[model samples]
Target: MDAVSERLAEVHGGIARALKDAARTDAAQLVAVSKTFDADAIRPLIAAGQRHFGENRVSEAADKWPALTAETPGIVLHLVGQLQSNKAEAAVRLFDVIHSVDRPSLVTALGKAMVASGRRPDCYIQVNIGAEDQKGGCAIADLPALLAQARDAGLPVIGLMCVPPADVEPAPYFALLAKLARDHALAGLSMGMSSDYPTAVLLGATVVRVGSALFGGRG
Candidate 1:
């Protein structure tokens, strides 16, 4: 096996063991962040039973989606980047779940795209828990409005997604997301990455996006 394949095996085993120890029957879903990598790098890992994957760019994901799906049937695709309004159609067609529904305009665009495509996709409301201006998530105060918007648009509100600030500990952020999910009565929590997944898992993260840990550093 290649290095990526080997790393994926190790990571999967670690996640499984972590789940067992945590007594989490779901043990946090691992959406391999396959943003920078391509089919060649991901195929082996998929062949080794790693299915769910995430991507950041609509254009890149559009290119990779079909080939990857053909190579590994039943794989779930997630969009984990800042989704632009213009790319909403492609996002709906390509991703099974969108983890970056942060803005009202974007949500409306997605709803329109779903109407045109005749398919309503699952989604998560991204929360800017860190209050970072440079980020693409909604301010925490705007979540209820956003969630209501998504619900009214016929989209299935899966849960909350966020990228905690660089310096802050992720447990609190993950914990906050869990609380928010409980408050909102949503089922999924898409938080954490390679660096903070353990913390995220501990704090009840249902979905964790890990990239470099599975496929190594991006170029």
Candidate 2:
């Protein structure tokens, strides 16, 4: 097998093991994050049967995905980075799922954009699980209000997404996100990356955003 295919297989194996250990019959969706990489790098994963992919920027996704999606059937694109309020319309048009709905203003923008474009992409409220200043998730304290705003605006808020502080044990953060989702009656938990996805699965992540494990280090 080629390098990408080998890596993909390894990731699938890891996910399977995690699921078995969790004793959960439901499958966790793996969103292969294809942010900086080009289409050439992505096609191999798609050919290897990866349907859900994530991009970081709206413009970059627009630049690449139109042609790629037209050629491949059943591709679900996710915006897994912070979205600009101004680009909501374009983002709404391009992506199938958005994992960074973090604030009231952004929620409002996305809601309006969805109305204008007639496309409602699945949304996950990003939580600042680590309370980091640089990250793009909503503060834990503000989650309820933001969620309420998102729901009122008619955005299809499905779950919660989080990126824990780097270089720390991520299990607690993942567990916390899962708890928050449960508290809000949300079923989806979009957490974990290449480093701690198996732990995340054990803690109850319905969707894991994996990038480097599948694509290798970004250039």
Candidate 3:
């Protein structure tokens, strides 16, 4: 197998083991984060049966994915980074799921864009579980209001998403996010990454954003 295929196999193996340990077989989905990587690097993983891929920026995705997806079928694209209100229409057109709907304004924009484009991608409310200044997520106290806005605007919101503080143990944050999703009766939890996905699965993550593990470090 090629390098990317090998890495993908290893990541899939890890996911399987984690699910089996958690008794959560098929409960979670792995979103191979393809941010910063070019299409050449991504094709092998697709050949290896990776269906879900995530990109951070709309412009970069626009540059490659239209042609890529047209050539390859069954590829689900996810927007796993901060989104601008101005780009909502483009995002709705390209992404199957958006994992960074953090505020009421963004929720409104996405709803409007979805209407305009006749596309409603599943959205995940990003919660700043760590409350970090540099991070892009709704404050924990603001999650309810944001979620309400999304629902009122008829957005197809699926669940909650969070990125834990890098220096701290991530389990607590993941657990808290799962609890928040449950409290709101949301069905999806988009949490975890290369370092802590297994822990996330154990803590009830329905979607894990794994980048480095599958594609190596971002270029």
Candidate 4:
């Protein structure tokens, strides 16, 4: 096996171990965050039976994934980055899941796009868990209204997502996100990346977005 394949195995092993340790052997799903890498870099993981992958930019994904998906069946593409309202139509057309549904306007745009195209992707409300100015998520106070609007617009809002404050202990934020999901009755928790995913899974992460741990550092 190649280095990437070995890394994939290690990450999967970590996930399985994390789940077992948390008494959740089957609760969480690993989404290989395949943002910057091209098809050649991703082939090993696909050959090793990875089906779920995530991308950051729709334009970049459009350039690479059409050919990749044509070759590999059962590839579930997820949009895991900040999405502009203008890209809603293309995003709706491409991704099977969207983990950044944060605003009422975006909800409206996605709803209209899905209506016109007859495709509805599963959505997760991204909360600005750190309330950082640079991050993209709905303010904590706006979540209830935004979620209601998303549901009203016929969105399949299944979960909550957050990239906590960088370089801090993420456990508190993960716990807070879990509490919020419970309060709102949402099912999935799209938290965790390469580093703190084990903590996230322990706290109730149904979907962990693992990138660097699987693909290594991206340039």
Candidate 5:
């Protein structure tokens, strides 16, 4: 196997081990974060049976994915980034899953966009789990209203997504997200990254967005 395939295998192994420890039979889908990497870098993982991939920018994904998806069918593109309300139409058309539906304005934009395009991508309400000032997630205090508005707007919100405070233990934050999802009756917990995905799986993440671990560090 090539290097990327080897890394993909290792990450899958880690997920498998974590699943066993969590006593959960269902598997957490790995959305390989292919944000900065181009199609040449991503093809190996796709060849290795990876169908789900994530990108941080709508424009970037638009630039790269159309041809790639044309060549290789069954690719699920995830937008795991802060989306601009203005770009909602493009995002709705491009991404298969959106993991950053965080505000009322965005919800409204996405709603209109989905209607115009006839595509309703599954969404995850991003919660600012750490209450950080610089982050893009909706404040925890506003999640219920946001979720209600999203549902009202006809957005198919599947779960919660979060990025914890950078250097601390992420378990607590992951646990909090999982609890919030349960309280809201949301099942998809789109959390975790390269550093702490195993913990995320154990704590109840249905989708893990991993980048560097699979594609190696970006310059």
Candidate 6:
């Protein structure tokens, strides 16, 4: 096996172990992020039984989905980055879940795209738990209103998605999302990344998106 494959195996095994130790009833979903990677690089991962992947750029995802899907049937694709309003239509066609619906305009566009395409993909409302000015997420105080609006507008708001503060521990942020999901009666938490996923899992992350650890350093 190649280095990337080995790393993927290690990560997957780690996730499994985390789930076991956490006493989680369901195994954590590992989204092997495939952004900045082409089908050639991802084909081996598919062969190794990886069915879930996340991508950031709409254009790159568009380029990779077809060939990757053809080679590995039933793969789940998630758009996990800030999606532009203009790319809503194409994104509706490509992704099975959208983990970055942060703005009102984007949600409107996604609702329209879903209406046009007849595909209501699962959505996660990105929350700026850290209150970072640079992140693409709704403010904590704004979540209830935004989630209510998104749901009423036909977006299937599954749960909250967040990136924790860079230097602090992730457990608190992950716990915050889990509590919010409970308050809202949601089912998932698309938190964590390559660096802090174990903390996320322990804190009740139903879905974790890991990129560099699975696909290696991206361009």
Among these predictions, the greatest TM-score belongs to 5
Highest lDDT model number: 5
User: Better model by TM-score, 2 or 6?
Assistant: 2
Query: What TM-score do all the candidates reach, one by one?
Result: 0.93, 0.98, 0.97, 0.97, 0.99, 0.95
Candidate 6's residue-wise lDDT over 1-219, tens digit each? Answer: 877679888987888878888998787899988887878888878887889999998898987688778866799999999999999999999999999998789889999999999999999999999899988899989898889889878998888899898988888888988998899899889998999888888888889999888887877
User: Clashing residue pairs in candidate 6, if any?
Assistant: none
- Assess each prediction's global lDDT (C-alpha) against the native: 0.86, 0.94, 0.91, 0.93, 0.96, 0.89
Residue range 35-66, candidate 2, lDDT tens digits:
99999989999999999999999999999999
Q: Residue 153 of model 5: what lDDT?
A: 97
Can you rank all candidates by lDDT, best first? 5, 2, 4, 3, 6, 1
Report clash pairs, candidate 5: none
Lowest lDDT 10-residue stretch of candidate 6: 64-73
User: Where in model 6 is the C-alpha error above 4 Å?
Assistant: none
> What order do you get sorting by TM-score, best first?
5, 2, 4, 3, 6, 1
Residue-level lDDT tens digits of model 3 in 1-219: 878788888877887888889887567898999999999988888888899999999999999899889988889999999999999999999999999999877888899998888988989999999999999999999989999999999888899999999978999999899889989999899998999998998888889999999988765
Model 4 Cα lDDT, one tens digit per residue, 84-131? 999999999999999999988899999999999999999999999999
Q: Model 1, range 10-71, lDDT digits (tens) per residue?
A: 76676676677678887678899988887888887787788899999999988877976886
- Model 3 alpha-carbon miss at residue 12, Å: 1.2
* Candidate 4: worst-modelled 10 consecutive residues by lDDT: 21-30
Pick out the ten consecutive residues of candidate 5 with the lowest summed lDDT. Answer: 35-44
The digit string of per-residue lDDT tens for model 5 on 1-219 reads 878789999999999999999999998999999988888988899989999999999999999999999999999999999999999999999999999999899999999999999999999999999999999999999999999999999999999999999999999999999999999999999999999999999999999999999998997
Clashing pairs in 4: none
